[model samples]
Target: MGDLERELRDLSTWLETPEPPDVRAQVRERLHRPARRWRPLAAAALAAVLVAVLPPTRAAVADVVSGLLRFAGVSIAVSPEQTTPSGVASPLPGQRVAGLDEAQRAVRFPIRLPAKLGPPERVLVADPDPTGACRVATLLYDGGALRVDAFDGRLNLSFHKEVIPPGAEWVEVNGDFAVWVDGPHVLSYVDRAGTVHKESARLAASTLIWQDADVSYRLEGARTQAEAIEIARSLR
Candidate 1:
């Protein structure tokens, strides 16, 4: 059978299995609800009547992610280290980044932000010397009210800001080639030469890209396009 049909059938069988009384009642209430026929008809009619009535789903998600990033004034990039997996040890206190040039290896100064932004929730430092040749740092921020930032050799921004449709999940079009169900929001950086990537799944918001000679970054979060643009502009 088709995947969707198979999934529905499996779900039906699971629902038929024995369950606690309360759980069973809740399931019944959900499955036995009256079908709304007019709604579909109405949607079709609306589509016919107004060509622009519904925004494209992928565009909608991208817009959301971009907006949030812009609001935070963050930048996206793809680092060279991301393309190759590095088995680096976790950083200990008071250690420097290994292998990088004297200047590139260290931030030298703390990152100063505008008054509008909050400090990161957590910071991860990688061992200066790892078994492999690769070395990088990870920075995490928990922007209050449901925003999370995971910045490693790459940066990922995940915000549980909206209610996703049942069975919905996030997907990326490009960058490191990974996918997950119930995955956190991600903004990643890779080497400069890689092709631009685009991804679309349920509730994606938007994806943004910034490039430089050494690193390139991608932003995937739940914000509007204007917000995403603002964040992109803030990177210096």
Candidate 2:
């Protein structure tokens, strides 16, 4: 019985009483320390989001140039043989004539004419006269041995061979096709198929055609046949 009482007393002593108030307070502070440490991390995340929402600082000109070069399938090589422009350069070759200088505008493209075809002299915009607006450029090749006429815009192309008689309107003669631009002038050309190809566009329309042989083209943009004749006379 005495041994049992001693055992019970030992157990009671082993079972500790409640902690002191100061000790309990210290434990609570330690548990909350981790929460306080996470406050700065939350602020840093918000700052990163603000920065991502801001716009860029510089314009993308390089991207534009790269796209043009890729679409053209050509590379620009600056050699010592070429000359630099002194000021704002014109789009068309300087040597060609502009019949409608007052109304025409110029634009540039990175295109090179064949050396055998000589060089382009000028490019002009054909407008106002009802033969559908056209973007036209002329090339005098081989020192007058060849003349290349390029007309750009939406065109209806056909072929025939017949030299129309003078004073006759839209007559087919000589088995040569003549392009009748809703106006008085007519363009004529013969192809390898012995077929003549004719193309015409209305005022405000554009056309592009290229030929390697000697061809007689008619400019129909002039208000009168005399004016159309004068435009043709200026070709080469």
In terms of lDDT, which candidate is strongest? 1
Question: Model 2 residue 157 lDDT?
Answer: 25
Q: Tally clashes: model 1.
A: 38
User: In candidate 1, what are the lDDT values of residues 77-160, reduced to their tens digit?
Assistant: 212221222233222323333322431334322232212234344433332333322223323334422222222222222122
Task: Give lDDT: candidate 2, residue 199.
Answer: 40
| 136-171 per-residue lDDT for model 2 (tens digits) | 444443342233344321222222222122212221
How well does candidate 1 match the true structure in TM-score terms?
0.27
